[model samples]
Target: MIFSSLLFIFRFLPIALAIYYLAPAKLKNLALFLVSIFFYSWGEVRYFPIMLACIVGNYFIAIFLGKNQDKPTVRRWLLVLTLVFNLGMLFFFKYTDFFIININALFGTSIGLLRLTLPLGISFYTFQTMSYTLDVYRGEVEPERNIIDLGAYVVMFPQLIAGPIVLYKDVAAQLKVHKNRYTLSEIDAGIGLFVLGLAKKVLLANSIGALWDDIKVLGYANISTPLAWLGAIAFTLQIYFDFSGYSTMAIGLGKMLGFNFPLNFNLPYISRSITDFWRRWHMTLSGWFREYLYIPLGGNRRGMKRQVLNLFIVWCLTGFWHGANWNFLLWGFYYFVLLTVEKLWLHKPLAKGKIWPHIYALFFIVVGWAIFAVDTGMGDLAMFFSKLFIPQSGISAGYFVRNYGLSLLLGIVCSTPYPGRFYHKLCRQKKEVLRIAFLAVLLLVSIAYLVDSTYNPFIYFRF
Candidate 1:
């Protein structure tokens, strides 16, 4: 049940929204919780118990932490226990096989892999629950006494699987509000944004992604340098549109439901530095690490050396958080190195430059995507890198250009801020009829594409 699917769009969403709107004000959260659990169970029913355990366990732990705030020693121990519970579940499901394979390679032990299925959104919900518990311990927010309201927050379907990673504090007030939580204007905006995102995912990302799929079928060793670069750029665009489009839809749906989810991507492709890019990309995740991990490790308060160490640890975990793959680790460290250099040296120079900074940032960003997308193992990654660097004349990119030129162009343009600016300008000019008409066309086109095409793939669902 991806959002792009006809079944979800026509069946589940319409029915769910109807049920939600018809519920009484005080029971809205209960309705939301029930519908959300059904949504999750529809996709991953086998892991329904695990999700329940997570919600129940974290709910009680947070309640306990809120109760024991006066005792520092007890609160600290409780926080530690909650961390172990959350992170332990994440590691056991996500990384157990990776550790086993590594140990087998090193010490010749044939430990059979458990190969447990990762519960969908465990990575995201774990962070959300942990943030709640941690904030309760810090006295930043009160513990949610009502388990149904807390469950509603944890399993909110829109951002549950692939998130902007909503925090508890961010929505605490909204969850408790009983009246006038939403407006007709907000619903109108949400519909427009959702249609825009649907167009982005169904039309642009899927079409551009086909070129990369073609290149993968041809194999890296057989591709020319031009085609390799094209494939990299295509993947870069595909991932951006896929994940950011999903995030946009999530945020839009949040608005429709009277919640304001935080922004995830902010024209990250336009960033001139790795540091700036992180600030824009998966922003909630970065903020999480910065607040919960980096600051606790002293951040920049202690000294340059300590700050560097803090960055290193955060990046390593950040990379691993994406997956159990070694390439992800390298991809993370790759940014760490770039960000370190930029922070210590290149920051001022990049700021001063105009065109070259964009070029440099995009060049490395594309290369980084190449690294991230090559998941077959180190051999394929090395061969792909060679194809990128060591030029070869084989299959030309001209054929792909002929096939995907318009989509590539649209993706490139949309990755910047021009389209967004145009939309805002329309709003500013009081062009309500024009805006609604345009969104209607986009929505119809996206629905047609969804009905006709079978290539819709969401990149972030695995995480």
Candidate 2:
């Protein structure tokens, strides 16, 4: 169930929190694990076994890694095997159909598509488990001996589906060492964080997303230049707030449980270049690739040529990680190209200017999202790109502006750090009553919106 859903907010979370707080000290992990399973199963009961099997499988794999840690060759072989198992599961569930369709078209072999449904959070949990095993092999962190704690870490519902991709080492200490888990102040802060995130999703992302939907319904070929740009910018805003909002909620929920997940997003829109953008956006994923994939693949240490090839590989894999689609691959390579350009030449120029840097960043960012949005065919993407440049004779631009002008303005404003700064400014004045009242209103408004509408999908769920 999505965090924005009424049932999850009113029923599952409340019950889970209550049981967790009421449980004995040692039983807290058990409590969380049980509730997390129930929460995950609420979405798809059939895949529940797959998730459990993963937990069990990885738990043992980690033990074996720990046992053979002193032998470098044995540890390397074990790490390879564990990654293969984890990544193999991820590929089979997520990419089997895409591969099947390509094979059928390429060689005229009628390979029937398995059309397998991807298990919820398969990519996330697999990465988490793989990281754990690798860390154990590398002696970066102690292996978790208790399967219960390991399961709890993997199945933690808050960030399970869409994550900042929490690493085992990050939370291992909290799980095994920390005794006093919760504080009233931390819970209060969590509530405030969650309320703000709810407002971002229900009030901002969902509302702004409607404009993009309207453009899609009208079809890209029919849209004017301004309308095409408007749709692209609207989606760019929608996805940021949607995914970042979910991450904020996840982090807030982590705080409520006295755990801290790494922050997933900074003000990425404010970035001046694509290189700066990756540094700020979905930070955990980039860090994961940097440490586990890029660094291991020779990184920049192997000279410029190898570094460039390494980046190409990482970007291709990163794109395919998002979905089983060619556009995603294009989107990945698109950034690879931009980042390569920046590294070789444009970095200094883009870093020097203020207004122009922002303009440059925003132009490419919007264009990238346009590539990300279209799904059916390259023709549709080409049509959208054409509309973005050529001014077709249409009056939809004025109509969209009239309809979503305020939302667009709010989106642009909130994309910066101004609202957060304003909130912090208020906090400095000792305005406890004002802060609580504001959060209460936000919660009420979000609840009202949730009750009234059903267009509340978090964009990262597909990944």
By lDDT, the best candidate is 1
Expressed as tens digits, the lDDT of each residue in 244-346 for candidate 2 is 8999899989989989899999999999999999999999999999999999999999899999999999999999999999999999999999999999999
Worst 10 residues of 1 by lDDT: 454-463
Q: Give the poorly placed runs of model 2, Cα more than 4 Å off.
A: none
Candidate 1 error regions (>4 Å): none
TM-score for each candidate, following the candidate numbering: 0.98, 0.98
Residue 322 alpha-carbon offset, candidate 1, angstroms = 0.3
RMSD of each: 1.0, 1.2
| lDDT assessment of candidate 1 | 0.91
Alpha-carbon shift of residue 72 in model 1 (angstroms): 1.7
